[model samples]
Target: MAYRRLSNQSLVGVLIVLVGVVLLVDTTGLYDTGFLLTYVPSLFVLVGLYALVSSDFRNVGGPLVLVTVASAWQLVALDVVTVGRILRFWPLLIVLVGLSIALGRVRPSVAEVDDDRFDLVAAFGGLDRRATSKTFTGGNVTVAFGGGELDLRDTLVPAPPARVNVVALFGGVDVVVPRDWNVRLDVLPVFGAAEDDRPRREAEHDGVDLVVTGFCAFGGVTVTN
Candidate 1:
């Protein structure tokens, strides 16, 4: 009476199998199912929705925009909307981006020390921050058309689990943590990548467990020791 959650690999495998079956059906002239292709754009919408639910709505702006665009694309494909009509509202994208930036610039949840938490944003520029907090908590990072680096190697996460939420759009963000700590990466990449290049620890240590969760669009997020 219990259902096990599907892993990313398992979900991808299922998707591949479904796609193959559809292709086979179409190739063999079983049925005129070409109409299903019109729903391809909806995949992005689904991804955005999944991200929103997974992150508990803490990260919204980027995913919301992605969902909006994908929905528009799907409408166009379904002949419910036209490309010219969508073009007329192109400036709305800029307004949304501005709002996202403004909303993201906020203080962290807790600030026990001067450097316990931080929020960094880099747009059309670069930001380099080094945290030396003895009890590092958590923070947020945003990079759009720029790059950022958060160095926490000198810090100590006395609190077992510290979370960092990141959003990279057409840019990159690098997080450098201690070599002995464990990293739990839960980032979503859309036409982008989020990589952990840190070497595995041969032995386990009772150190901080960093949780990096966010989404990247046409960009990347890298974690290293």
Candidate 2:
């Protein structure tokens, strides 16, 4: 059979053996003491090994290795060898390290801004509050909102022919427009709904044309003119 990927347990066992050898040779005085004290070194070895296996070493491995080394130095400095002392604090250490690793895994999207427009895109893995807004020159504008709330409004300049394109996905989008402006809105099926509070009459003044599109998993969109 083809060789399968090694399990975390096997990796941990190898690391434990190596650490035990080093500890035994480096600290011969350990055997003179009771076995209860040996748990401290064992615990540190296990934690260091676990961190190495669980962490994404390629991208974040260097810092994590540094942390493990620092922790080992601290243990040596304090002479933490007693099993009772090790057990008393092991749970707290594990919890703290686990939480830190979890938080470090979170990544955010990149936002780019140019002279004429701003573009933002991100893959928010399940639990993220999407909130953003941008304003630029009212010429061929495009807006997209997905899986969250989007509020877009355009201020009409004294100039004529202001065109906007807006796209929203799966969530709610709200847009505000001038009272007396000629505007056109086209929404795809992906967008939940579109509403206009203003009366359905042609505006006497030249107004801004806003178009929006995007998708959301749960939230809805709202537009006001």
Candidate 1 Cα errors over 4 Å, as ranges: 7-9, 27-31, 107-178, 181-223
Q: Report the poorest 10 consecutive residues by lDDT, candidate 1.
A: 105-114
**What TM-score do all the candidates reach, one by one?**
0.50, 0.31
Cand. 2 TM to true fold: 0.31
- Put down candidate 2 lDDT per residue, 1-225, tens digits, no spaces: 899665433444475486677567557864443343444544554454444343322113323443554565556546765545545655555565565566557734221223233222211111122223233433221122223222233343334443333333333444455555455554444425555556743354444444443332233334455
Model 1 per-residue lDDT tens digits across residues 5-64: 654334434765887888789889998678886787897678667655643454456766
User: Please, what is the whole-model Cα lDDT of each candidate in the order they appear?
Assistant: 0.74, 0.40
